[model samples]
Target: MLKSRPNAGRSQPKQQQQQQQQQNRQPQQQQQQQLVHTTSSHYGLEEFFDSSRNLGERQVKSGRAWRTDELRLKSNSDLHKLWFVLYKERNMLYTMKEAAATEYELFPSPERIDKVEESMANLENVVRERNNAYWQLEVSPCATGERPSIFRRDVFGRHRWHKCSQHIPPYHRNWHFRNTQGPGKTNETDWFFHKYREMKRKHYNYFRSRTARYLRDLFRRFPNADAEYIAELHPEFPQGYVQHLKENHVLYDDPPRAATRARIRPSEDVQQ
Candidate 1:
């Protein structure tokens, strides 16, 4: 009687196991599909494309730049998100602009890129303001976390603000450092400085002389013109110099009366 059901239990169990394996794989397949869809939506190729508009379209009007006041009102996280949005927008615009240039076509709404840049600048300024205020309150009044700059003279003896960095000081014995520190107080440098000063002085004198001559001619042409207006317009001409020109310049002279009209004499024949 037991021999009749020899393969029945094994066959039923194998079929059940197969069904269970398929059921387990179904959820995983659905999960994988869902993940792929989410990823595609988040980072799609569509981002590189501009908004739906014809290639020949031009002059698309847009809103003004984001103001610092408006940006300051937003939370840091929101600002961060906005920055990335604007950054992506700028990159897209640049791409579109280059494409238009290559195609010999006009780029629509180029100012939109400028607006984006200005908004980004405003956002950064607001963030920097907050950072500075926080540093002042929690740390020290003068302590901004930014790098400090030192006033240093270049080879030309021009003063410039150089950012301090992690490097050997100018006084160090390093040859590279000494060479880059500029020609300090040598006879050659002193002579060069003297020559530079002399050149600047000559330029100033030449400019002053040219300006004086121009003022002299202007006053001569417009003797009745407002002296105060002239002075205001050309402060480079000193008040005393302008007054002297007004008083002493010959061009300021009034024109002499036209010679009296020649007396008309009637012909002798007409008298007869």
Candidate 2:
């Protein structure tokens, strides 16, 4: 037979060889490399960046954070899903923010971070409320189904609402608790506690009196305002409290008028 052409039966090109190898790969191997190939707009690490549409935009319009009422309506499973979505969104926003900082670029719509955090806090609070309710219904000894607390001194001698934890022995018997927390009742602590109580009492009294005075003035200024609505808004006050204040304004420390007509009026004597 005639000699074979020089190019006949030659090896396949490098690109064609790679294509054949990829095609011959086992299904398991392909799955291992990538779980599923989808025709999504963004892929891989790009998912964690700002969207293509908003990449260079100065402002991005968005909705407000999810409210507690809205979240409460969702079931546990739905809440779980939303939580992950929000988490991923938070991560993406943070990544973009950090990148901007590194590159001396302005992070657009910084309030997005605040909105995300607020939603997260609301979610946490909702979960806590549900947990507390569940404990109250099924297992709690205390009224709140939570830790019991008392107004007590901290290590620094500062008084606060101290939450008590379960101990093998009573609080008095537990030395670890005592040493970790400050020594409870001594002359020095007693003196400080008394002084702090006095100061707090004075501060509270000042506010209460001031609030009462303001209520009286408002009542006097707007005699026809909805009394029921005002009372509802400031329910801390007794039912007849504002009326009593209006009748006896002098009982409050606030003066009726600091400057009189004689002092503040356009007068020739004052000019002289």
Candidate 3:
């Protein structure tokens, strides 16, 4: 018995090793069970999964968007888990959608996409708010320098602008001038400005052509239509425009040709 197992250190029995592996896996199995237990307690997660399951039947199973306060209260692990669940559900829905499209059938619960998207948007907003707050408190400014206020003139050289922020340091009071060159004086020849001018010119030309054509047609339709009234109504009309109509027999009627007297009266008198 003492001389015992000669090669005991060399190799363990297969059955023993199998038993040890089972023992090792027990803790992992318990941990997995705990993970499941924790996930089941999350808010709305079960409902989200349920809605996903009925995507083939329902058309409006999407839940409301998550609010920031609620997200802020959630633990990091829970949020992480939720992200993965949402991701999986999205993939599942997308797969079903593609399949339905291929079969030319309705992929029920179309609004689920919108709901998921809204939730994602809300989540991103919450994250951004928290991130900004954290940065402002801890880092003293955004990762990039404080966002500068911006101002710009409209295409028509008009003042139309917005102020982005108000954290200008006293030393950089001249930052605005440094970044923005060229005086604010109106420059109609600027690319956008010129484009706007050209657009206005084309629009005016179109109206002018249309007005002239309409007036010509009106005279043709009713030779004695109101001319002076129109001229008075549109005093801004070009002087040469109305004059051209008068010269071309457009605005005024022509004089009738003179009638010739018959020579019959003289002939009759001579015969008498």
Candidate 4:
């Protein structure tokens, strides 16, 4: 028991120990570098900065938007990844646009934002389609978890589709405690509705009068214009209104030189 084993406390060689330390350090250093790279890559301000060519350019040509059909063909996972990509792109573009505006420089290829938006919308639609399909196959139709909406009249009597959310049952006395508690009609609301109706009526009358005046002016300016063509063009105008304009506004005169020349020149050329 008192005698120690010969190799029990033997230390590694300096060369071997140093080599081992170097190997361990390599991986740790590599990991640190990778982490730094990842962190820098995700910086929002860096992403928002424009490329050299686009920084001060007036007009930059870009490609079209991602089509719905193209997005539909992608897998859910792929679309999920692409959604974040587009979202980041949109944020970057918005930031760049704001910067450019502040600097009084043109934001080149502004339509890129629109393209990214279109792609994101298509992606969302594809995801929604998949969700609907999954719900139909695995869950009850009513269990899709989307908010149900119904056309309901508000306090002002305006009908709109109100999105319904889970709430306390109607029988609960405190259920109507919310600031937006509904179905309460007041005199103020009635008066507001009355004014809204009156404003709408005025707009309707003004639009009708404008249309009549335009028709009268057109008839006066081009007396020989085809009544049937005019009626076809303005199907919204009553036949009686068209006839009234023709009889009252139009002056019977020879056709304008421009119209006569256009008609006569073609026919003479044909005869020749």
Candidate number with greatest lDDT: 1
Candidate closer to the true structure by TM-score (higher is better), 1 or 3: 1
Q: Local error of candidate 4 at 90, Å? A: 2.8
In candidate 1 the C-alpha lDDT for residue 3 amounts to 72
Pairs of residues at least 3 apart in sequence or in different chains that clash in candidate 2: none
C-alpha lDDT values of all predictions: 0.81, 0.79, 0.65, 0.76
lDDT of 4: 0.76
RMSD of 4: 12.5
Error of 2 at 162 (Å): 3.9
How many residue pairs clash in model 4? 0
Q: What tens-digit string does per-residue lDDT give for candidate 1 at 1-272?
A: 59758688779999999999999999999999887754334547767868776457768878999999899899999999999999988999999999999998899989999999999999999989989898999999997867788887766665678776676544555667656765456777778878988998899899988776777777787877676776787777666767787767785544555655566788988964
- How far residue 181's Cα lies from its native spot in candidate 1, in Å, is 5.6
Check candidate 1 and list the clashing pairs.
none
Residue 72, model 4: lDDT of 88
User: Which residues of candidate 1, in runs, are more than 4 Å off?
Assistant: 1-54, 80-107, 142-146, 166-178, 181-272
Tell me how far the alpha carbon of residue 123 in candidate 1 is from the true structure, in angstroms, after superposition.
2.2
Candidate 4: tens digits of C-alpha lDDT, residues 49-95: 65667766778777787888998888878888888888878888898
lDDT of 3 by residue, 1-272 (tens): 55556566445776699999999999999999887764345555444343444645746445676777788888667777777776777776677688788998887867777777677666666666766777787878745334545566633464555445444554257565534642344554366666877898999889887777767666667666667777776676776565466446543543444545444456655865
Report clash pairs, candidate 3: 59-109
Clash tally, candidates in order: 0, 0, 1, 0
Q: Give the TM-score of candidate 4.
A: 0.62
- Candidate 2 lDDT, 130-241, residue by residue in tens: 8788888888645455678889768656768977777788878878878888555777777887898899899988988778767777867776666677777777787787
